[model samples]
Target: MAEKRDYYEVLGVGKDASDDDIKKSYRKLARQYHPDVNKAADAEQKFKEVKEAYDVLSDNQKRATYDRYGHVDPNQGFGGGGGGAGDFGGFGDIFDMFFGGGGGRRDPNAPQRGNDLQYTMTIEFKEAVFGKETDIQIPRTETCDTCSGSGAKPGTKPETCTICHGSGQQEVVQNTPFGRIVNRRACTNCSGTGKVIKEKCGTCHGAGKVKKQRKIHVRIPAGVDEGAQIRLSGEGESGVRGGPAGDLYIVIRVKSHEFFERDGDDIYCEVPLTFAQAALGDEIEIPTLTEKVKLKIPAGTQTGTYFRLKGKGVPRLRGYGQGDQHVKVTVVTPTKLSDEQKELLRQFSGTEGEATPQEHHETIFEKMKKAFRGE
Candidate 1:
């Protein structure tokens, strides 16, 4: 005894075959196995198998029945009616079914919000810290006054679309072997607006909007950093169909300073110190954000000494009180030497006392002391 082949295998398709897939496979197998085209002994048998598979799979009810109960007898079951094998005229037909008309459609006459706009503003470092208020001119669209936001003329009015019956859309239907399908698309007569203007406004040329410059006042707050955004309400482009206007966003760009580097709210800077002032105690003047302040240097101060000045940095953006300023001192080496100065330095070195550097700068100091003692 021989086993029966699956219907999906006969049509060369998966178990979940679509109508188009079954139709295509049936056409190809029918042309290949027909007695007029093929002379093989099994050609007639193969053609019958392909026809039976397509007839069962192409119908939704029959396919569901076959899936629920496997290998149902076609002669005694529901949806058993089959088309003749020579029904080639209906090969290119397609059908789609849609329920609840106008459920997913958008009305052309509905109000819509305007688009938001963005602008970049560059300011100096001091300006960002102190903040300022200024006015700016921006060109944007505005509603026309001639037709009062309508695209029609002053006396005449807009007419409803005749093609789509003022619905702004049209339905397309296609007939297939199983049933019919309907597709909804935008209408072409009135450009989906559902309204046609025979006579256009003179000022806006039927657009219902005009291009004009608007002056807006902006106030920048203190302690604003780079990439900060300030929003202005109702300052964007005009909306269509009497909708509300959008917002305007202003992005900030802070300029760099030549003498100072900022890290968050803290300020960092390097100051130069003379060799005499670093070795011996001295009080020097240092520049702060506001005024010059006096900073004391210890007698044994080495290079790269850091000093902090309270309440001298930039103001905090989100809290109370100001940040501190960090100052780093770099000792300047003397490039030129006088003859008398060199002799005095040599005599001082020959009779110098045993004074070592700080622990952090004690590199090679102990070795030099051992070499001097000959130990």
Candidate 2:
């Protein structure tokens, strides 16, 4: 690769320029060289160069390192800054300031990656449990079949820009404390593209791309939770001038289930039991992620007791095996009893010890009294 261009010279602003001045100048140049309006051959290279320049001068730490070492390669960690990790943070602000908002206007000659697309998918509860395959249709940009993304008419090629002489840049010299500083700005006449298209492509109108509907297939892995994102590389919008395509992200939304609630990979459900069943131990069937399982309730089983069924919940999202499902007990009392049943219960209650009744009723009263006292 050729030696990289100087950071100060790339943005066309002076080395001592303030942050606001650099930003303002970059925005102006970006608009001027933007591929949509300017059809120069070197427009894309100029855009990347400006972006790289802003990537460095905007940050305090990176800018300090560059100022001290006079354009030390930050990627090499020569002066003080760390490797590429430091480089991206500086650019992250730039991306947010520009592309982070609503989409910018489209340019035909610009070498831009296709626009990213998002699709919302609703998965059935059962499918969320076991995972499933699905297909979707997305409307996006594709390389123009007729012009092949060149945006120029067939049999015609772009000519060298008369203004910039193919360098796509113009340099201006200014006096500074260090010495005379030379700055690089995108050639105003060529709009940064060293070349200009004489006869535009008829099909794409020199856009080099076209809009079309495409079908994409996605496989959802098992145990995907709500709001999970799946990325489809190179499936987004088409790029201009043979640029790489953008990515497609699928966001999943899980529908609510009638009987179950999820806690991470674990499934929970409440099982109801009649008084008779609670008094006399019985084997009851409960629902699991895969199938039904049997749970045995011991005699005199109390309400709210939880039972764990190992490996019966959802599959682990990050690890192997499945989570344990919990079954909570809720004892049901009869609202109305038959005359004979009422008499039998009264007789049984009479035989029951007074101490048992006092223990239950007194405990509740004490709690109520404490609550009344604002305990």
Candidate 3:
């Protein structure tokens, strides 16, 4: 496989580009390389690349992830700042040694954001196409009401830690050949919380939070494809020390439709037509996303020919208008035939090329009808 280009580079936009700027660039490129409009051999591939880039950049969450971690390989999962996790860890270690910066020495009482949560939801194909509003229950940690997030009993309060003077970190000095090195570690006396609750809160057992189930209502929009995520703001675990709550991500898994196959917003399916119908042409009912509509098959239609139904596919995820539905027709040949039918076919074979295909088709239909009536 070839290496992929940067998404921003693919869309020809800067990292700080606005959402409208990204969408505008995508629309321009989509029209420029549309396979139906551009006849170049690589037009389809270019269109796919543009679509992929837009899919990532147009999504705020995905774009932020890309910005933080450049080019995360989908098959290999997310990598760190550089190389494997060990290399990233080693780099962090070197930085911490030079500058007094590490998580071990951080202020424990500082406000910290809660951890984000993820839930996988499987929905029906029609539900994904049409959208839905539903409720889900998930277990998460929440701040204790009784303790007021302080881990203290009802009438009591927490006291500052005696060790480390409420800094929550213990420091040590070592004399080296180059200079004296100062190392810091979390103070074990207060468990790095910078406060001690002599009488622990019975509700939370000295912790400032409690585990509970939360009900969240989610709205899945129309045209959501597989693996697409919906972000719910501040619906994750409760924050620590008055910090902001994290977000909850709902990942969608759309079940496969029995007949319809989707590619982007386009719908594709195949319909079978009998020999007479293919040769003589007919108006047949084709199923769209919403309803069944009549599709005209021109006379002398060949197998594998596709007819497009405009505005019959899925709605665009971001903007107005609907995609197209592509219907391919395959001709089915008869396997079992009556003796009279065989004779008629033989006669037609003897006179092959003597009449137009339409005439032959009409002749076969009439003969078959008469045979059915025992004429």
Candidate 4:
């Protein structure tokens, strides 16, 4: 097998591209490489590549994993196939786009998946740098225990709808000038359920589900940035009529650190240095994500100079290796000085061919007098 291309490269998008940008790029590529439309020999292969790339990039968790790991296994999360062209009504929409209308209507009576839920979770900066497990309380719909999602009273089953004969649909014919038009819509009597509950479930009021507070434990991956999302499959609301449950999305918000800031996987912090330390090289301890490490500041190092400490930053979320920590040097100036200290600094300035503090003050006074006298 050939080595796969990078997902971002395949979709012609940057690694930091937004979700909408990725979607637009994938759609354009998919339309161009669609086998039925392109008719080229390699169109099918290109289409598959586009689909696979979109499948990984469009999902937050998969994209994060792929970004850190370089490649993702097909069986990990891409196996079920829920994104890209397949998600846009599959080939039916493609055929409709080229050949014109024939898209089928979804069956209203079919078991519908539960609605996905979103929750914003705030964590400490350190917790985001190093992964942590925590629990959250969320209110979601759960299947009622009394009726077991049947929506009927205990010991009593739902009856077939009399209006549509339990088909969950009704057909109507209209006489028009063009011809007789036949149409099918959901059965009004049973609301497309094909059944009617004579006695509603006492616990859920015939809805077959009830809202309750649930405590869900979430394992947050390391190196998660602000606005990063963690997906919990089948942890959302319970489905209707025994359908599959939806997903729960945990949106992460990392609190700001007093000394450190994060950029992607890297950590950044500013370290203060004295003028003497900048002029004469000195070894100082700097704070990393985990601990303090010794950093050597070279002689004559200027303010705003950045020093990189490799493998001392946040760990990759799911891949090997760690990001580097950048320390920015900020030279501090003394606000007050003793007479002896000032005299030593003046003597040092005389050797360097610069004016002493008293000589500089006299020069400035003479300039002000000359300017005042227009000389």
Kindly report which residue stretches of model 1 are placed more than 4 angstroms away from their true locations once superposed: 1-102, 176-179, 346-375
Q: lDDT by residue for model 4 over 1-375, one digit each (tens)? A: 898888799899999999989888877887798765799999978877877787778878887777777665554564244543333413334435543345455554678799899999999988998889988999999999999998899999889999888878776755432123345678899988789899999998888898999999999988888999999999999887668999999999999866677898898877666667776778987767666679999988998999999998888887989999998887665545666667866776312112233333344345334423433
TM-score-sorted candidate list, best first: 1, 3, 4, 2
Worst 10 residues of 2 by lDDT: 350-359
lDDT tens digits, residues 1-375, model 1?
Answer: 455577899889898777888888877876677544589999977766665667777778878777777675564253343654334223323211122252456788898788787888999877787788988888888888888778888998888999888888776765533223355677788888888889999988888889889899999987788999999989988788899898899999999865666788888877665566677768987776667789999886888899999888888878887788898887665545566656755775321222333443333334323323432
Q: Which ten residues in a row are the worst by lDDT in model 1? A: 91-100
Model 1 lDDT, full chain set: 0.72
Model 2 / residue 324 / CA error / Å: 2.0
| Candidate 3 per-residue C-alpha lDDT over 1-375 given as tens digits, one digit per residue, 9 for 90 to 100 | 898888899889999999989888877777677554589999978867776777667667777877887776463232212233333212234335433565455678899999899999999887888899999998999999999788999899989999878888776765432123356667788877888889999999989899999999999999999999999999999899999888999999999865678999999877766766777788987767777789999878999999999998998899999889998887766665666666866775321122223433444445334423433
Superposed Cα deviation of residue 153, candidate 3 (Å) = 1.4
Ranking by lDDT: 3, 4, 1, 2
Best-fitting candidate, scored by TM-score: 1
Instruction: Show the lowest summed lDDT stretch of 10 residues, model 4.
Output: 350-359
**Model 4 TM-score (2 dp):** 0.63
Which pairs of residues collide in candidate 1? 96-181
